[model samples]
Target chain A: MNKILTIMWKDVRVLFQDWAAVALIIAGPLVLALGLGLVTGAFSNSDAPTIGRIPVVLVDEDGGQLAAALVDVLTSDDLSDLLAVETLSDADAARARVAAGDASAAVLIPTGFSDSFTPDMATGEMPASVTVTVVGDPGAPVGAAVVRSIVEEFAARADTAVAGVRVGLTQLAGSGAVSPVELPAVGQSMAAAVFADSAAASAASVIRVETRNVTATGESFNILAYFAPAMALLFLMYAVTLGARTLLSERREGTLARMLAAPVSSAQVLGGKVGGIFLGGFIQLAALILLTTLLWQLNWGNPLSVLLLVVAAALAATGWGLLIASLAANAGQITSLGMALTLLFGILSGSFVPLNDAWPVLDWLSRITPNRWAMDGFVALAAGEGGAAVLVPVAALLVMAAVLFAAAALFFRRRQGALLTA
Target chain B: MTTPILIAKDLRKTFGDLEAVKGISFSVLRGEIFSLLGPNGAGKTTTINMLSCLLPPTAGTAEIAGHAIPGDTLGVRRAIGVVPQEIALYDALSARQNLEFWGRLYDMRGQALTQRIDEVLEQVGLADRAKDKVKTFSGGMKRRINIAAGLLHKPQLLFMDEPTVGIDPQSRRRILDMVKELRDGGMTVLYTTHYMEEAEELSDRVGIIDQGRLIALGTQAELTRVVGEQETLRLYLAEEAGAAAAQATVAAGDGAALPADGGLTLFNGLPGVLRASAIDHQIVVNVADAGEALPAVVGRANALGLHVRSVDIEEPNLEAVFLQLTGRGLRD
Candidate 1:
């Protein structure tokens, strides 16, 4: 509608009126992405940034089967091209090596690491978790990240093997292929034997994908590709929140009432505000993508897919912004909560660091935020997963948008009798 | 005479148990300035909000330019322009931009919207500052542009709800003149203000509102008539003389016998003087003839060793009428 467009036009013009805000929403992220890229050394003339094989020390504190087996994985053929592996008996020695910049990172396998992984029949702890500490030097950021990524890749494959065994054993007991009374003992023995110091066997019968594969594009994990979308999305929440909060500000300023007093309906006003935020977010995203591509020389593949991703990301973020605006009691609340949520989403979505190469729990938790979907789509594009590869994340983003929008609509209706400022 | 531009029959609005606008009604003839004269919290702004379709009445009905309220909210909104008590222009935008933005909302576009924006900017005398951001403008300039925003679409009826509340006198004067010009050009207006002088200076018919009800509605002459043939002669006395004069008069008894002496006696004996009361720094005389009583009052004050600092004579006004109706001063 003309009225809706008019409303959006007014809002957008108002948003652009403050040059500082425009700069903050657009250029701030561009600088951060580039700065982080330079910090991580994710820029180069090649299709991907190049870093030589990083020197890594593997410290096996636990002489258990899992620790020895994981150390074997660190020295495995798949990681040998990117990592020069060394054995350290003491974690302190490994830490000293990394701190001295003699090594990119040190992977310390703590005591009880494998003992936890082996199912305990008496303790009844079926799915076990143990912390694997990776200490990295600030001097070798990308190499350190790569070293850390390899350990996570090995851990992921082991987790898959254990989970597959548990599921199979549970099914067997249920189907009477194995006696119910013997299921726990059967699982404990199978797990203990599989991961024992002598048997370093990993299962292939379960669904698995190589966590990080150095593909044909000459690209490895680049920080700029990750941070560009991460920082952009982090501030995109703010820009959208800023836009949404103005609806309340305008209401207090009497401009909203004045507009409502005109030949305009409430729906038109909402359409304009939501549309303005949606469009502003997309512009910010596109501009950041372009600016990062130019400034950092980063490859964000499949232009069409990137555009689609930006739109979907904007939709999901704007929907959240509207939901926050509706639920927030005032402008101050919207601002503070928006900022807090942005940081939270950023941290949870692995914007600062890839959660994929970190804890599996955190990686799973990232799914709840739109930033995760957006980051996943962007990371996919960066890795040369063409247009169609991004569809799953885009679909995920749209579903989030639909859910958030429905909730926002319900809240808006409930609060309709009161003004936005209220 | 042809048809009323706006009419309301028993419009009511309640927020919880507190009734903001009681069941009340009035009509505005085409091309007339109908002023709602009331102090703050007398439901003036609430009434303006209701008539402008900014607030839906809890009960009753109304029609603006033949379009009904609530049921035809969009229609009513289309027929009216509302300049709220607050200066509602976007401070971030330019004067011209603010006008253009609001103009488009009223459905004007392209050259017509541009031309109308220019016309309204010029109308409010802000044509020169069209490009300057409104936040950079002076308060009066902002108020002018605020009014300019409302005038963009040239609606059939305009609602100016205390548009001159907090501004310099020069700007207030300009806005008053602009309101008159709009009415002269055949635009019906519903103006609300607590200032009796503003209502007296602008309205063809005044509606005196008090506590959610219209207490009186008539022309200036009719409203003034409510207080009767009365003139107040305010004789400002010196600070020391204020209490002395009143005590002197009370001692002199009834202020009618003249005390058979001189000094304050002459004030009691002044012809057409009905009652002389001194309070604070001013001696007020309710008189039958102000013109004839002024000289004698001043002479008596001088004779009584009371310095007549200044003197003022006021004709009975809507303030007096409001006092007679509500038993309290309008400003009270």
Candidate 2:
């Protein structure tokens, strides 16, 4: 262990001693993340052009007032550019339209849906909720997901508006602002208007512009949050791979041969090299995580969970690094192979962009990369899902570490007869 | 006299069909410098590598500091230090760091490692440059640090393989001096070099090797005795007039091929001339006296109508012994 630490310390010292390398490894990822976050974050601005319209089929089974108002809200002039709504009479036709790819989603409003959400409901009494069934298309999930979000937002706002109308109209009548005979009509009309227009537009107009942390959402600043950690993980592989490449470089420089000539065992030498790569990768990631937190205001996840994932992620990355080193004959080969693998795995695992879930092949390919598991872990942790929520990702990361380390060690030993030296 | 610090009997190494080190056997006496003298690719470095534990021999029985090879590799390594043919110090690290790292590998730490580093730095005359990065230093300075690294643990035996292969005169002198200093301080040294002068100047005993085999081994004086008391007479003729007409010029051992001046043939009949051979424009005459041999050598050259550029007398030495044993110069 002492020898391992000594080797680790020597490599670490060499890493930090070159200030250019230090700046590039630590600051390069931060600068890149910020640039990407800003570029991607720009599109999420509220004032920017909204996405294209989603084709939606609406089937109102209930000829009631509440169901009619909800259809009016979805087809209102304000959402005319965002949602291409088709009012269909047959529920089977609406379902077929979604299934046949004619529409992104079909919204079915069952009978008695409007009855439970009427303005005549007693004040201070809980209102009976309704379930809006939205059948979405498998081919066009993005459009379907957008339509589903707008509908859910409308339901939440409409529920709030309906409950407030009853108590407010009575108060207004008592205060003499409105005549008692016309108060009920005024409350119904206001509730109807609330359900007629764009609830999302109104919500957006309420909040002032401000930057916030990265979360897996479509908020104004969520892109920055999404990209910052993803970019950090992507570039972290380069830093750690460079650290691993040093094992080959040391051999080229003859330091490894010199070390072997000493009283130290080959196992100790390789252990030190492996330790250096693991720690270097860990330090690079931890620094990036901290930097994003302090400067970009991006929260990675639960601190302990991030720490645990970072350790496992570094180990797994180092395993790849050693594997690259083991296969490489020299530092130059390692550098080329390491950088190539870094970019290949980074892009493959959806570090730059999400893998298309519709494509099972790409998803399967992504599972083979450390980036996928690491990103999944970070995503879960960032969602504030600490504790047991992180179990699978953490376990996956450990498994990756174990399997890759074993493979790398086996190849490295075959090449150099060392514990982990490449 | 002194108990042998290192002994090998029938050490051999084969790489595929090629035998890198053929059945070779030699030993190093305590506190003595044993120089393995050979040209490049002569298996000198291979032999050093085998003994250094860098490579395992195909077949051998050897022990260093009472530890056997193969069976006690770590023990053998613990008892010996190696300054390889290449400067093996970390270039980016400071001299002190390089020393410290190597020292730690030897399991030396605390004040002992530090003191040893200081001592080695002082010994190699690089004390002032200890804090400087090795890459920033000159080649000579880097070589010193490399040597310093090997000496940090102060093993019982040191293997210096062609340590001064490429260096300026001053640096080479310092390293050779350092080797002698190490020997004088009671350390066994096995130095290998293609440079005959370095071997003759520094080694107590010389092992002449060629083509993966040690051809000859003895002290400089003992090896030189192979040529007896006869001195070598060199005739430097024009290249066109040399090895081409060397036979005509030497005129055989009895001077029968040379033109006769009156009744006596022009060369070999001289009292000092013992034997003669022709090699590349140089007619080599082994004689009892160089002064008496010079006139006869010039007379023979004139009789053969070959132009004699100059004459030189080479005393019996390791170079001559190597040439005498292998029929080739040591540099070949």
Candidate 3:
């Protein structure tokens, strides 16, 4: 145990003494994570323009009073504010404009404008129903809905004005204040027509829209809260790879063989190396997490849960480093192989991107990589859930670490004699 | 006596089909500098490695410091210190640090470790530069540190394998002196080198190996005795000396009659000359007494109208003995 401690101390001292190693281990991950987070945030913020204006084109075919009233309502400020209204000469032209993406929808009023408003005509089967053709862009559903609301408001206001005159006549008859012959003529007049037009326009101005973004579960998307865990796990992988370089350096310098020649057993030597790298990896992760929190205002959920995740992540990283070093012959080979594998696992594990929307094959592949489990654990912790939910992934990570560490130990034991000779 | 510090009885080692050491055997008494002298591929290093238990032999056995090879490899490893030909010190570490590291490996620690490190540093004459990294040190300094690291454990038997392969003359001398000094202090050493002078100067018993076989093993004088009692007297004749002039020099005075080989004039029942040969404008006179015949041969050459450029009298030595035994030079 003393020998193991001595070896461990020497390794730690060497790593700390090296400026390049320290910088890469600590500062490298912080820089990469913060840079990627800020850049992605900037792009998402800039590209997602909020819904403000809906474009619509109008086609007024009737030359009569009713047509003029409907057109007035459609062109009023209340409707125009929600929909950018463009006047087109014909229904065909309006449809063309909508198809060209210049408009969200088109409202076309037919020729029978004043006829539909007469009391007898309204009571009987309405002639041609004062048809208003509505054309809309297929893709712009919100713009189409805004246009529909405006048209509905105009129709309801016209119907209410017609009903008010009937109510007044009925009340006068019931009171017996005057005979039916003494009543004013019910034929359409210019003043009444103009007054009706003004009423429709005024009613359109009074219409109000209250849109509520309601989800099935009543939760809105929070970008920062969603991606913070993934970014942390990615940086953790970077830390692990950087820390693993120590193993390759020792092997290249023959210092490892020199250490083995001491009275320390092979297990002690392996343990010391693993412990040193594990500590280095954890330090890097802690620095990255601190920097991310300070710079991006990242909330890492519960402190205890985050700490547990960090520890398990460090162990898994140490195991991965050992496994890579054991298989490589030299430092360059180790770095190349480690970089490739880390990238592969990181992508499959959704460290850089979300795996939920990823291809099905990739989702399955994530299950086999420790990085995926690590990321899952981070997500659970970041979501303010008791990391108890992350126990399976944490256990899986621990098992992976044990398997890799054991393989590395076995490799070292088998090659112990040959290494001495070398 | 006292179970000989190291013993190898007909040890053999083969790498695949090639036999590197073929049944070579020797023993080293305690507190002696035993050397194995051979050319580069002559199985010296292979034999030393087997003795040090760094490599296992294919056949036979070696007991190092009273422990058998393979059977007691760990004991043998603990009992012997190996200074390999290559510089194996850590380049990134200081001399003292390297010593401390090796000391800890050998189970020395704390004050005792520091004390040993200081002592070895001073012994290697690197105490002033002990804190400097080894890569910054000179070749000689690195070699000294290499030797110092090996000596940290204070083993009973030390193996120095080609310790002076490439170095300045002063450094080589210093190393040789250090080896001798260590042996004088009751340390048994098995030193191997191809340089015959190194062997002649330091070894108590020298073994000559060639092509994975031990061809000669004995003291310097014993090996020299193999060349017999004949002495050679050579006279460098002038460029213009002809065959008649050479014949006249050989035939003068107490020199005997000529032999059937015309170039060689054999003198029997003479006072000094036993055989004479002339080739390439130079004459070699084999005499019974080089001390007596050299002057006489020079005088005869001067009298025969042959101007002697130079004259040399030589006695048989290890080179001649090696040549006689193996029909090739020691280096070959």
Candidate 4:
């Protein structure tokens, strides 16, 4: 135990002396967290109506009074301020525009739209409704819904005005002295008058939607939260690599053979090396977490759980490093193997990208990686739930660490005999 | 004297089918610097490693400091220290730190560890540079630290395998002197080196190894006597002495003429003939038996108008003895 502590102390001293290692372990995470936070912030605040523009397309097919009235309504300064409408000559062109994402939606008006809304037409049969076709990226459901709201309001106003016009016409006919020519002229005037009244009523009925996002928990996802954990894991890998490099250096310098010549047992030497690597990895993890918290306001809830996860993750990482170093004959072999393992495990662990709903095979493979379990624990803790749930994964990580460390120790002991002979 | 500090009775080690040490046996008495002198690939290191408990001999038993090796490896390790051929100090750590760390490994702690570290540092003449990192140290300084680390525990037996290879002349001499000093201070040392001079200078008794076998073992005088009573005589002749002049000079010496070849010829005993050089007018003669014939040979050469240059007569040393026994140079 004393020997292990001595080895750990030496490793810590070396880590503190290296400036580049300090920066990568601490500052790198904070920078990443800040950047991710700002991006999430920009995405959430995009729904405000402050001179912001939403692209829309106008498809007017009627070329008549009512179609013109609808276009005029859409082009008014008040609506234009919220939306940027591009006029398309035909429905086909507007659909193409929306499909290609050139605009958010297409408003189509049928031919003879004004005639369809007559008093006789309203009472005898229901007029064909003008369709507002919104073709949009399904991922942007909010934008599509906003466009639909505007069209729905416009339709309601048009319906009420048509009903009023039909009632007035019926009253005029009850007077019993109207001529047929005067009736056509009155119908035309009535149609024009109804369109104007409906436009006014629609304008008055326009309800501006104000969106307020509320969550039960007030936690905001920031860059620090997103990148702090990842950077911690990355630096943990680097610490392992550094420790492996030390092993190679000792072998090259023949110090390993000299150590074998001492009274210390092979097991003791192996234990010392593993302890050193674990200590370095722990330092890196702590620095990353602390820097992320202080610099970018990263929230790592349940400190005890986080601490446990970090320890498990460090052990697993250091074990992997020692195993690689033991198998490798030289520094180059150690480096190549270390890099391959780190990248393979890091990707599977979802350090760089989310793998929540990944393929079933990938999910199973991730369970075998300590990094995956560690990242899951961190994300769960930071998201403020699943405290007891994280214990299984953390234990799995520790088991993996123990298995790797044992394998490394066995390899080192076997090699010690060969090294001594050499 | 009681148990013989280390004993290897027919110790053998094999790599695959090739035997590195072939049933070699030797013993080191307490407080003696015993050397294993050999060329490259002569199993000297293999023997040392087995005795040091770093390797288990393939077919024989050895005891280190009264403890059986391999069976009681820990006991052997505790009683012995090893200074390998290669430098073994950590580069990142200071000399003091390295010593302290190694000392702690041997269970030396507190002020005792510090005191031992200081003593070893002073003995190796590295006390002043103890605070400096080993990477900044010279080859000799690193070698000294390597030796110091081995001595931190003050073991009864020390195994030094080619400890002075590729070092400066001064450092090599210092190390040789230190080995002698250590032996004098009551530590049994098994020193191995390819350099015949180092073995001849420092070893109380030398074991000459070749082809994984001990070819010869004895004191310097005892080994030199192996070449028999014949002495080697060298004559430093003037450059102007032609082959004929050299040949005539050898014939004139009071030794039996054997053959006349190259620039000169050898005589079985002494020749009574002389010839003079053209430029310096000098004559040189070399004889196999110089002691009985030197005075007569010198007189005859001077009477025959031959100016004698210089003469040296000495018995065959280890180098000659080795060459005669192996039909090859000691270094080769």
Best prediction by lDDT: 1
Model 3: per-residue lDDT, tens digit, A348-392?
A: 876555444215589798876777887666654543456585788
Model 3 lDDT per residue over B1-332, tens place: 24488888999998889999999888888988888888788998888778766567899998877789768766777788877777766676678877876676567879998988898888888999998888899888888888888788887888888888888888888888889988888888889988877998999888888889988888888887766776766577776333654456465742444433343433233467765555456566666688877766776666666778888777765554554555444553
**TM (B chain), model 4:** 0.77
Q: TM-score (0 to 1) of chain B, per candidate?
A: 0.81, 0.82, 0.76, 0.77
After superposition, which runs of candidate 3 have C-alpha atoms over 4 Å from their true positions? A1-27, A34-38, A41-356, A359-394, A405-422, B1-3, B41-49, B52-54, B165-174, B195-197, B223-332
* Candidate 2 pairs with clashing backbones: A214-A225, B242-B281, B243-B281
Per-residue lDDT of model 2, residues B309-332, tens digit only: 888888877766765676555553
Summed backbone clashes in each candidate are 0, 3, 0, 15
Pairwise lDDT winner, candidates 2 and 3: 2
Model 4 CA deviation exceeding 4 Å by range: A7-219, A245-249, A353-365, A406-416, A419-421, B1-3, B229-315
Off by over 4 Å in 1: A37-50, A55-81, A87-221, A350-365, A420-422, B233-309
> TM-score for model 2?
0.72
Query: Which ten contiguous residues of candidate 2 chain B have the minimum total lDDT?
Result: B258-267
Report residue A365 deviation for candidate 4 (angstroms).
Answer: 4.3
Give the TM-score of candidate 2 (chain A): 0.61
- DockQ of candidate 3 is 0.07
TM-score for each predicted model, relative to the true structure: 0.77, 0.72, 0.55, 0.66
Candidate 2 lDDT for residue B306: 71
What are the per-candidate TM-scores when only chain A is compared? 0.69, 0.61, 0.54, 0.57
What's the CA error at residue B94 for candidate 4, in Å?
A: 0.8
